[model samples]
Target: MSTSEPVPDPSAVAAHSAPDAPRAHAGSAATPALRVRTLRLEDEIDLPAHLPRDLTAAWLRHGQGMVGIGTAWTCTTSGPDRFEDASARFRELAAAARIDDEVGTRGSGLIAFGSFSYSASSPRPSTLLVPRAILGVLDNDPFLTLVDVLDEQEDAPDAAGAAPTDWRDLFPSTPRAERTRVQIDPDHTPDEYQELVRRALGMIEEGRAQKIVLSESSTVHLEQAQPVATLLSRLAESYPTTWVYHLSDVIGATPEMLADTEHGRLFSRVLAGSRPVAEGSELAEQDRRAFRSDAKELAEHAFAIDSVTSRLADLTTEITASAEPFVLRLPGLEHLASDVAGELREGVTSLDVAGRLHPSAAVSGTPREAADAAIAELEVRDRGGYASPVGWMDAEGDGQWAIALRMAHLETPTRVRVQSGGGLVAGSDPVLEHAEALAKSRPVLRAIGRPED
Candidate 1:
């Protein structure tokens, strides 16, 4: 997407409005470029705290990542080819860009923060957005990058000359959230969801699929609209280790990485199998041990790992995976977790790898095609953006994308939909699966300031 209109002055950090249209192509100008200028900052930034209240986009994890305001351009598409469409559009923008990067790091120039829906059939279009101004921190160093699209008539500005001495002054004011209460309503009743899991197990037994992931959502109705920044800040504070993201209407703190590609390296974290970790340390450790040894959980986790590696094998070299999954502890549960790494092929972008890795046995089921069919037949409610990829990719096609887990969709000012699910195998227990889904929902629920029921 490109625009011929003159971009706002780089010195102005105030929020600006983006076009409402889906695609903004560079008009048939003789020359058009996506111009990016990076200015390294002198001080360290305290994330979530330093994040502005009205952030348009963000991808933060472990106190690093970027927060952006306003939209410079957008590449939005729907249906099965969404990933390809967005990737091609971004590649064009990046290929023709003019960049001055003093920082010259992974995320230093021309970044598009993206969030894709879980299903291609979803009416909600997946988005790749380029924010007008960005403040980011990577490798413990902070920097500011001003992004714009320039037509043949405009001249690219100098980075150092336009940068402010005090980068802090660029930020807008943040306001506190009003204490709010929410009305929660599950999409499927406990019994209904249990029946769904039972049906999935039946399908597995009948040889339709080896495993199927079933999810449930609860609509959170607020008395009044709550600021998304407040919820983002709360999630970041509580789950600092998870990727805290807010792109358009989707917001979450996800622990599972769908893909993280930098230079030629590809890294992914696959999570499956779960045990709710309540209060007692001894009990939690016991649960962790039992979880590690449980045949059902181990089998479920194995399916997830294989799903990732098999796909990586096609796009990467020297692929490596953990021999055994480690216990990944979170606020309310522990997951069987494994890390997979590889070197990407010459032309594979992060999105390409993500499209292939998504709906892995971790999220879908083994025998992907069969599992997805079962999900369509059995699942009454749509998954929306849950279990999908959400993150940013720089102009270099190097970026991070995480499964949109532990997340909620702000459907409106007052209504947020929170979702969670678990993998189901032939011997899975419906009641236990329902409990596990609830356990997975805790982080977002707690972040919303509500105790889990």
Candidate 2:
């Protein structure tokens, strides 16, 4: 998909009228009306397995036009000491952009962007991008009309006449295995962990917040430095369903929401109690079936669904939630999942639901505020962009927000930083907890050219 020239700004063009604006119809329903139009892609395509190359090609061809791309993968961890707070500063930049004001008050239909993740310790981060401006840009471009065109080349024969292997090789080389090493938090005494959890629980009792996410860090000392891109690609390959993404200083590698509209076209999948659903050839039938039947794991997911559904109900009208958890299989792993839908009530917006449901039990823990504080004290490193909400929403309240996981931020190509951790509860074991963290980092390590073993 390519375009010839720079796409004109939608704002400069005749305003198409914001999605939230009331239409002036002579004979509409008497009740206060809400109108929503779906932005369905005329075509959908899966890019050739050679993602980076294809991405580069697409960029060269259509970089002039406003384009939207979604990259999903598992990423590598750059070790615990590599984490930073660049996301806090990114938030400041967004605030400076006045994105909230631009989209909320001014009704400019501005873009919304951010990151989401599962912990401060994920090796793999997922990301998604939906540029609202692309709608206007592609309005006149024939090459960009279908989503399928992007997928069209997936099965096409390679020019060299060799059968395509797994698509993972499309990217550059990842870091060597020798560089992967685990580190322990110097300050993480057992007493300290207990204290942190106690204080977090107290905060919940005090009503500062319901649940808070807490993290404990284990540092991994690398034998040598690795490239950030290599780690990102590994993560993408490992977890195809997860929205693997990397910003210069931010990462969003989890599956949350992407481009959800009132009219009910949601680009992303919500993982709750059942396994994530798999599409595409990357996942095998046996793997899919096993993922679908994992009940013990599903129980773990129910808390997440209950939390999200309850929060949505408090904020919206006409809410509907899935009764059973479904499978959501990404490239590297699978998740139990569900869906919640509802009409936005009066005086409510997407961000409203987001705020209410953030630090979800899936990422944080039950009794939110307490879990968060526990994570802060127990986890040696600050989360920065890890487990935060990241994505874009437009002025029309049509946008996506995904949990950032399976991701890393490039502090420098040779010195990228990443983090990954898991949810802990009363039954949690410290050793198993540590292993889970390591498993999560596999994606990032693979992205950066590190071996899983």
Candidate 3:
């Protein structure tokens, strides 16, 4: 049951935020050694699962791409000016790409898998990378992309170009333990998070800002470091409908769609307004109706929709949005979800759309700048790629960018920092929001083999 649907776009969502642009490669900028050529592989393969040795895995439904960064010419960038920096580098790299599209499709050529930090101020984990070798599975068939690092005199595809045949081993097997003990750091106690929430709500009351998204970061100590594949596979299995991604050390299943663009058609799904179906809460119709009618939830959802539509309106034409938000049910929660679709203007790259619509009210808040300032002043710790855009873009500018949410950064093998945040609006209760943050962490927490309490 492999569906090769085009990828779609997310929310805990700000792991690290950045306006992504720079890309650093192995060679000096003057003598760019990048020579990328993609071949349509005749063989079918499972992506992420059978990724080449040490390759990064990314998937959105059936369409996926894996890249072996090891020995692969790679480009990385970080800093306050990373977005513009990475963008310039990507343009240069894409210019160097030479594609032999035997079976022309979205993922058949040079592509980059990226994870931007949630903010420019926190630059530690921000990355925009181009893999030396890309294995993309599109429409059940895979395409093998080979990148060459050539000297001034050399010009030809690498020896492996004869056939698209590859059977590279997938490393990082799943962990065997049923569960590992997890120690949630005390610095991010619920009380601390609640206080932040209270402060934001107070600001809303005082006309400081209509809304602000407040978040907390919790570090979990795992008994051991599980292979990233283990958590990615778990996320894919447990949240089959969501986009599962792993780049560098940032990994998780994101439920919201930031935006996806294909052949000029664009799709953006914004999810906000959460209702937790606690450990044993009934999913009764009466409860459903009450939640749908809840004023606070509706307000939150409206802000997200407005934020998306307002931004998309500038970059697209014939935009249309669902009049009402439908209930998006995940494992332990439900969210008010609205979809906006439009026809993109000419020359608009998917990343361009992502940059314009990011930090939407769904993840950022009603007034984006105000929420950002609040987050910077309060959350203090680096988000490490939590809520930024995490997805892939290609040479042709077709791609899917999902908001980094429901994620954690693997600071080290033994430590993964889980991130969660909620929209703070007037009349919001801090206690429930605290619970919501905990609920958001459940995905990453569960991924690390945390035992059920």
Candidate 4:
């Protein structure tokens, strides 16, 4: 349970870095690489199957891996132009390099990992990072990229000589997974969050808003800092059905697919209107019927669907959405989830799609401007990276972005903050909404080593 490894000094690693032979690379942010070489291999290896689950600036969803352990280059930025700004930086790096890929897949080349704030105005950090090295498994082909940075070497070397022989050589054999547990402490008690929920409902009654997403955050104090790989492994095991992610300091397993684009095909998953699933409870017949027939749940889900399709209307074609939502069950909760997919019209990028669809009614609320106003007035602390778009982007502008839900921020060496929220519509009950927030939060608590009912 102890996170006591003596991490190597980064400067020592960078001193030996260089690009491969026959390639020269120069980026404004990174020292010029004499050459960049990538060792790649192909197999039928299931995406994440049997891979050493190490802590990297990475993500694993639906079996694909996006690893960012040793980054040679990184971009940390803020403001409304954050996404485009990061993309521009990647462009600068790409313009000056030659990449050697033994096997070419979507994730075979230049890679970046991102974690953005819920709002542009949020004071929290927003980042886009690129590893100096990558151990990626895309479509079952594994690759390791190494950059050799030589200030002044009389002899340039072959890519193979400059890089580790095996990807396994990149990371040390780590400790087996842990059983670290934490003491749970919340920013607001259940009753206090319920009061905030009631206040939001009152704002709706006053005709100030149609819906509000009220959330609660908890700071968990561990006996020691939880090991990153151990925590990530537990999350992946606990929520295999979701996208388990860790980028910089933000981490979680989120079920909501904000946007995904591949070869001009796009898909987004909308989740709203939730119900808790106890650890070992098979719903009786009546409980299932009410979830399907409840007017409040139905309305909340409808708003989510409409929010997605409407924003995507002008950007896509052959659009299709599920006529009705199906129940999506996770470890401790269930939600009304709908899938919306379409083909990109012509020049639409995944980032554009994510930007437009972000703060969807599912997370922010209806009539976004008003809902944001309510949250700004009600939420006492910044949301950091929770409930925002978090994922990766490639040189081709094709990628996957998911709503950063069920997330926690590793605040410091000994502290982490888990966050969760609920959508409130007319006829909403504060007590019920508070319970929903707790259910949303429980996943992170459990993942961080709290094994409890």
Candidate 5:
């Protein structure tokens, strides 16, 4: 990893003509850059769900260095129906903001989307922003620098040095539900579900792929409408340790990982939900102990650890993984957890690890390929961004990326697509699997102003 500090004021960097801007070098010295754009629903006339995916994939295939992208939209109710029409409006906003010119640009940047349900009591209009820059000192350290940028932008004078909105305000707080009621649809059945698990287990047994991560999604019809923000707040508060993240139109809440690229580090707290990482927290020791020892849960966690370690061993010179798995608890569920570390080999990059370890066993199954194929066949809808990797990376081969969960895709208030899935194993039950999918989606469902039935 590059040993450099982020520019205190990224905006202060001397601007060069668009054509003359210094290009980012993959492994060379160059300071990463940050730029933000403001977007509104009116800007997006009509957009497609695959636009963002296409843009991101194209960048990964052709662009160098780091990248970050974000989009936000507002849900609006039209007539008695026509929710899908509204969703299209939001998607258009996202497509309009794509960074097409950055394909040949040097360095790295990120693109993302954000939005809120139209019914949100605190209706803060949504905005989608994308930043691009050549990787340099800033590339080495992202989250801190990015967080700083967010802070700066949030604090920047808005015609008057008024606060745009703190992170807290962007995501509102709500009461926690002691027992989250979830509903699953038994009608939608995909035959590939069972085959995927079998294929994954077969691969592990065959040694073709030591470990594979597989994921599956199930659509849910809530009992009642619940506010998306309230749901997210409850999940975040319930599982404070998890790296809770929300995307405009994806599914599920993810709170287990954070990336610190500058130090050549990828910090993952591979436990699920709300389990304790320390001793003196809200959860009792006995509860934590029970969570830690559950065989089924531990098996789920061990797959993640082994997969991560195997990938790191191939990319780094040295590695250290926690010997024992622990418990991770969230508002609605709990999971086993562990941590893994390694020093990136001189020329190796996190992207390499990301490519190798993505779809970790936590998301997929024991063997990767079979599980992925199974998911593709079994799932009722194209996941688009739901389970795919989402995060930022820079030119220095530094940036953080995490599984895009607890997310939704907003076409409009009336027309939105929400997705959720679970890791299935031999012993996995359809009923339980369906329930788990619902539990995972709680975060995004709540964010979009949907009431939990």
Candidate 6:
């Protein structure tokens, strides 16, 4: 890695340029008001298994989290102003929305699930979606919340028509039996991916950037349209440690938490170096020890650590980071991981923290702009939502946001793109880096039933 000067703190930098005023979306002025009602359920329910095929949004880990059904309101924005524009509009709506809570829990009241693109220039619009109904299990308490958008006269519908009285009515009666076979094909030749890695190494050699992350995608061709809920249930069951997420067509289990704000506290988990673990190897300690001592991996990890702490220091108080990184073992891979936390400064929303900490050295390279420029030039593909912040935030400005990793995007009924990438330093081997990307992709591949890679 280059011994170049460290990148400036992201908080010190100007926020992404946004319109002077928030632009309206479907849930904005179009609907005069939104009425939200939360009710506790008598029986506990499995969160992912109940996710419906259409208009579903979820963020779950260890079988506990929120699942949103049907869109009550949604906002889409693009360009540099995407985050700011969406955040402003959400704050406005949440502040105005009405709520009647019979079950007071973390995810109750008005909540919006969101996914942002990795780059401002991406053609895909970043989105924030408020579900018409929410099925959630936090701290083992099963509950449901319904949101009803009021018409122009600002009058809510009749009580019977406004919200479902029984939580059982909200869940699907039976699992869909429909299934489809999937074929995983490389979107780009291995040689092409290696060339991109070589170019990134050249940039590092020339001191253009310290470390750059390069990613590639694979096309998962399905024989026919498959139910997303089934695929998500598989992922949740297989990778209980990861946050299995679904926002629109985007679905995956991410191991990295970009930012999680709750009850006046902020927390984050950063992951960088990675190595594949044999599926059922009993002696994985050897690989774990080797990964820990590797100088290149340590260097890559340090950059990610500094990037997070610096940005967090600006938005939080009493900030502290993990003393040493620990190996986080997953289904087919393990990563060097560290946790950072602090007490939130007043009025600093989770989205605000995400904006400052995003493009962290783990995803983008050190000296953020240079690495971003390198990614744009070398990859030559719009990273629609890969490596971006994908999670949900509540009306209270407290929410969990995870880096969109180990994910696949369903482009259409028959086409899905599974993507993965790794960090590259001065001595990064193109061949090895390419292999690492494939290793990182194992989780999603295994989830979709193609474990033999």
Give the alpha-carbon lDDT of every model: 0.78, 0.41, 0.69, 0.71, 0.41, 0.78
Candidate 2 off by > 4 Å: 1-110, 116-238, 262-299, 346-348, 451-453
In model 5, state the lDDT of residue 34: 29
lDDT of 2 by residue, 1-453 (tens): 101111111111011221111112111122111111123233332222223311210110111112232221111222222112222222222232312221122112233243434444454332222221222122232122111101122633212221222223332223323344433232355566556556655665666644444554433334445433334444455554465544425543566552245433323245543222223334467866665665545545666667776666655667666777676655434556777777776645444455456667777776665566566565666665666666544444454456666555444324445565555443344454544444555556454444324
Model 2 residue 437 CA deviation in Å: 2.0
- lDDT of model 5 at residue 326? 57
Name the lDDT value of residue 59 in candidate 4: 79
The residue-by-residue lDDT of candidate 6 on 1-453, one tens digit each, is: 001110111110011221111112333344335788888887868776676654357788999898776556677777777777788878877877888988888888888898899998887778887777788999998888887766535375423223675765666632454445668888678998998899899999999999999998898876655566667777888899999998855889999999999988988999989886677542267767888888999999999999999988878887888998998888777889999988999998899889888889999998899999998888756888899999999988889999999998867756778899999998888988898899888777666654233
What is the lDDT, from 0 to 100, of the residue 278 in candidate 2? Answer: 25
RMSD of each: 4.3, 15.2, 6.7, 5.9, 15.1, 8.3
Task: Name the runs in model 1 displaced over 4 angstroms.
Answer: 1-32, 154-166, 279-283, 451-453
Per-candidate clashes come to 3, 102, 31, 14, 87, 0
Cα lDDT of model 3 by residue, 1-453, tens digit: 001111111112212221111222333334244566677666656565653224454554533545443333334556555555555666766786555566677776667777777776565645556555566676676766766544435565444222233534322333333456677884566677788888888878988777788888877887765656556666776777788887766887888878798999999888888877765354679888988898988898888888988887768877888989888888877888888999998988888887787678887786888877777777778776878888888777878889988888777767778888888888899999988888888887887876425
What's the true lDDT of residue 199 in model 2? Answer: 61
Judged by whole-model lDDT over C-alpha atoms, candidate 4 comes out at 0.71
What TM-score, computed on C-alpha atoms, does each candidate reach?
0.90, 0.53, 0.86, 0.86, 0.52, 0.90
